[model samples]
Target chain A: MSALLELSSVTRRFGGLRAVSDVTLSVPQGEVLGLIGPNGAGKTTLVNVITGVHPASAGKVRFAGEDITRVRPYQAARRGIARTFQIVQPFPGMTVLENVAAAAMFAGGLSYGQRARDEALQHLRFVGLAEVANSNAAALTLAMRKRLEFAKGLAMRPKLLLLDEVNAGLNAAEVDQALELIRAIAARGVTVLIIEHLMKVVLSLCSRIAVLHHGELIAAGAPQAIIEDPRVIQAYLGKRYARAQAGAHG
Target chain B: MKRDASIALVLFALVALLPLSGEAYWMRLGTTMLMYGVLAMSWNFIGGMAGYPSFAVAAFFGLGAYAGAVAQKFGVPMGFAWVGAGLLALVFAALLGVALLRLRGHYFAIASLVVAEVLRELVNSMTGLTGGGMGLNLPIPAMASVDAQARFFFYVMLLLAAVTFTAMLITANSKLGFGLRCIQQNESAADMLGVDTTFYKVSAFMLSGVFVGVAGAVYASWVYYIEPPDVFDVLYSVKAIVMVLLGGAGSMFGPLVGAAAFLSLEELVWRNYLEVHTGVLGLMIVLLVLFLPKGLISLSQRLGRRGKLR
Candidate 1:
């Protein structure tokens, strides 16, 4: 009914450099909000703050109506916030099933053994990785590895998932599959605040797109409106795209 | 599963009947093997499964030996003395693990190494309680023959090895093992996934201390004396690490295989090249690091995979 995640003027600073400034944002329950930004735009830092990987230097993070500003990362996971690393944190030597199972055990504490294995298998199947369940996680192709990372996040059964570039490095067909999986996830009542780069995917899947540039949110509106914002075009989208838009409009 | 159970039974029968030849030398060797097995297996819990390269084995072992020795002198039965030693080591581990487990990789390894060496110094300096470097003696059973005493200690060591091995097997299958493996792979990821990494690591440390400390106590009584230099020797810690690394650090049978390989290698070197035993062993360890970096277990696993391929 309310926002699943609320970042009120959230700021993350590394020394004097604010990676993410006082950027207030919220993702309503069951909505798929897209975050678009250029390099060093603090999309990852914002996700880090929400996932409790980095403590907010200022402001508050209210999730599910509870303030979780200072909660530890693991504690945040326990309270149903999950994330996929942009760089794909590989659990070397673990089987794909075991990787998912580790998340299931941590997220659900599924009394271990068979029940946990079953749950992990289910997640692997959902991520289209059931065939390579027993294969070492490192053995997966880059595309499958991305899916594995996403599946691991899904295994947590979080109310809100912070997917960082899940579609990155994916082929056209793979991206389509990923989009379908994300839509299915939202249908299952899980809220998604995705930091995606593919504008096509963002425009197609997201109900609203938020533009961040230089650690600040410059524009937030429907996908169509966000692409039209002059500030968004100036910072993120090149001047060429703005000129093309102006020429097409004239 | 049935085949595995039968194999375990055969292994059990082999160990239980082993030393029936009445040879005192073999009995002594068996005792040493089982004792080291217990130590290595204990280390495997923290080092192998938990992925913490702990160098505190000798500290716990020496502490256990002294605790048991003190209790024995105070008129406590030797059996209860071992239990007291285990409990003392457990408490020490619980406290030490909390602080030391924070250090990772080489920092953790060095810090743990220092704990044992520091304890050795304290034991050497504290003459009133631990007899300083002079050592403590155990009251030998007056009527017992050397053969009978050897057999008695051999069985005691076997019991200890069996207990530690069983515990290792149990942990290797539990959520603790899963959590440990996760931690071993990635501590931050494990924590992010909601694993209580600190709790598991510290628990593994304490588990290691309990068995190793108890084994040390039994060893003290069996040997009839324990000097701080001998019981708290860094060589003991090195041997345990070598054994675990040689066999397969994390698996249930790794330490057993390693202890056997290490002790056998020691015997071969000591008997055949007494003048250069340590040098030869050091060279062998170097070769082992270069070649069998994953230890002998990886070889076995490779062979098993080959068999599956067939």
Candidate 2:
């Protein structure tokens, strides 16, 4: 399949420091690409540039073959690009149903109230949050809040979804559940670019993995190959991987 | 259908009986209450729903009063003067919103307050049109007797209040209302969900200004006097904020309850204390904010729960 999103030579800066520098990445249609890195790898900065939350100092972003470098966040959303924040910002005062319904009505083009409600309910059910639909978003547990975040992005019906650390604070079982959900999301023909630190989730869900370190990509390949790459081992896996590699090489 | 019928019935009952009841003083007081209820409700549109506390109400209200006074000076009909004032206020609202809405949260509030002060000073300096600090006086309508004019103005104010209140109620449940609420909750998230935050904010600001302007027009006509200090009082804006806060900032019925409670307190305090009435009003606001940060309506709602945690 053709690439769904292409970031060519993207760079972002905050005063003197460059957050993301000359980064080029691509996610093909209906593919789950994992972006793994140690802290401060510019993974979240890349997401910000892609979603137009922050303008890139230098780069071109093409979505579905159209140059969308200067598009605003809302315009990018309308063009089938939606994202969740690492912090999981939901409308605190609104009911979970109202939160998703707002996304459905505004971004999904559901004019009728009943249709919006139905679509919102469908999204809630998809995220396993249907039972708590009437509850205030502020009342949700962290895992539920993450799910609501996903449901909110899903309500926009975007073709390209950016998931930012959706499994950060979950327990082991919750992590597995989230992994299943992420896989299901990709299985629905939606392309996903996930920024995560958990190797288990990345290894299990991603078709291809990209390792970033100190604002640069160290490796990009199939999951098994990326885990075994020399640079990836040096930058992330460290001494144990070095010893294993030495034993194999010798 | 049933709810609509009940609402219509309540409105009809209020309209048919309120003017006929009791003494002239009560009637005048009732008119004042409605006028303030209108102002409070209008403020809630921007401050409560859109989560932007604007302090430039005096600017819009003063502009409307001045517009009416100018129109009346040019021999415009009384009804046309009100319309002209509303349009002028709408224009002022759009201009002021463009400049002030760019400042978020507390900065927006302070910018609006500064703008109102600037407007007050400018109006005071303009000797030719606004009559400077001494203020302007309009000619009395020779066609109507004093009592007839008072009753007419009361009904006009009542009608304007009803229109404004109903419009707020309708819009609060509409798509625009949802968008405003979303903008308040999370501006960036709302933007990502396809809400035009700037447009919604400006529209709310303009809508609030239109009602406030209408109130000012009626106020000018009722008193048959227009003074810079009276029309441009910063207290008017404070009263709007106090009423909305007391009533329930975001609730539909909050402004009405707030206005009633506030005006009644003012009347009682003025009758009893006279000298320290303003201080008493200030104290009441402080106490209310201390006890119930969410407002009187929410306080009552919580009271029924018998201290159950929210």
Candidate 3:
């Protein structure tokens, strides 16, 4: 199948440092691709580049065969690309549903305020947050806040959704619930490129995994093959050392 | 929301009936109160809804006055002159909003303040058209008497206030209002969610300017005089902002409530202790900000919730 999103030699630079460099990747339509990496792997920056928060320094980004390297953030959203921030940035003063409805206003060719709110309610229900729809976004717990972010991104009705560490800070049960939500989202035929830290989620949730190390794609394959790759092991040496420390104490 | 709209409709009708009472002094105060209330409501579009904290109200107000007066002097009909003034202010505001709305928070507030002051200085220097520091006297269109003239301008301001109120209500549920509230809470997130922040901000700026400008036009014609310091007074912007804040910035009825309370307090202070009128107003604002951070509307909402609970 043709890719829904294709990045060709994309590079992002912050002054002297290369945050993302020559990263060419693609996600086929109706696929779940997990992006796994250590700290400062430029995973978030790569998503930023795709979502138009940061301009690409080199190369091009294509969505469904159209060049979108210079697209503005709102234009990217309007063109059916949506992203969630690693740090949840809900509209603090607005109710949780209003936050979702605000994003939903631009969905499916500009719905009226009431219709948009109605559509947003469906996304909130999908994320299991209909109960706290009237509560201010700031009052949500961390897990609920992540669900809110998920609902907001989904409200855009995106063909491609980029999730940034959505499973972070969740308890074991919450993580399982989130994985189910992600699975349900992908089942709707939407392409998903998710950045995740949890190896358990990376293995089970994603059909294919891409590993980034120091702004470069170290490996891209099935989850089991990526886990078995020595390059992936060497790239995660710091993580291995930390794991070794935990093991010795136990 | 329904309660707020009903209250607004009642207010519109009652204010429209004010001139019928035939009490000239009370009618005049009523006109001033409604005029200032419109300013508060107009300012709320930017400061309250969009969270821009703009001080460009005085600049547009002054520009509108000058445009209307100049048009009137050049043989435009008196009513049409106000429209000319509104259009002039609208164009100026769109340009200024584009340039100045880039700054956020305190920087934006201070920048807008300086822009108004600059417009004031520019108006002062253009003596030939504006009559400069000497000021310009408007030729009161052949009204029957002083009361008649007062009645004419009173009706005009009353119309502007009603329009502004209706506009506020419409905007409260409109997509623009939703976008603006999003921008106010988190601009970047709003942008990511497909809100054109720049367009929403500038549109609010222009919308705020049009009403305030028309109000200035009406005020100029009412007094039959215009001056740099008087028309472009920073206090006009300050009072408008304070009224919005005191009432509850985003709530539909907040501006009217704020304007009524503020105007009554001002009149009381001005009548009893004219010398310290400003000092008392300043103190009241300080206390209001400290005690009621979300303004008087929050208090009413809390009370209403208790009533429902009971």
Global lDDT scores for all candidate models: 0.88, 0.85, 0.88
lDDT of 3 by residue, A1-250 (tens): 9999999999999999999989989999999999988999999999999989897999999998999999889889988998988899999999998999988885445565678889889989999999999999999999999999889888898999999999889999999999999999999988999999988887788999999999998889997677767788778735575456458656
Q: Output the lDDT of residue A124, model 1.
A: 90
Give a tens-digit lDDT track for model 1, residues A1-250: 6888888999999999999999988889999999998999999989888878898999999999999999888889888998888878869889999999888888765767888889999999988999999999999998899888878888888898888998888899999988898888888888888999888789888999999998999989998788888898888888897788679778
Model 1: which residue pairs collide?
none
Instruction: Give candidates' CA RMSD values in order.
Output: 2.1, 2.7, 2.7
Better candidate by lDDT, 2 or 3: 3
* Model 2 misplaced stretches (Cα beyond 4 Å): A241-250, B1-12, B299-310
TM-score between model 1 and native: 0.94
**Can you write out model 1's per-residue Cα lDDT over B143-164, one digit (the tens) per residue?**
4687777877888888888888
* lDDT string, candidate 2, A203-233, tens digits: 7899999888887777888987887787888
Ranking by TM-score: 3, 1, 2
In candidate 2 the C-alpha lDDT for residue A58 amounts to 92
Q: How far is candidate 2 from the true structure (C-alpha RMSD, Å)?
A: 2.7
Model 2, residue A224: C-alpha shift (Å): 2.4
Give the DockQ-based CAPRI class for model 3: medium
Off by over 4 Å in 1: A245-250, B1-6, B141-143, B304-309
Model 1 in CAPRI terms: which quality? medium
User: Looking at model 1 chain B, which ten-residue stretch has the lowest summed lDDT?
Assistant: B1-10
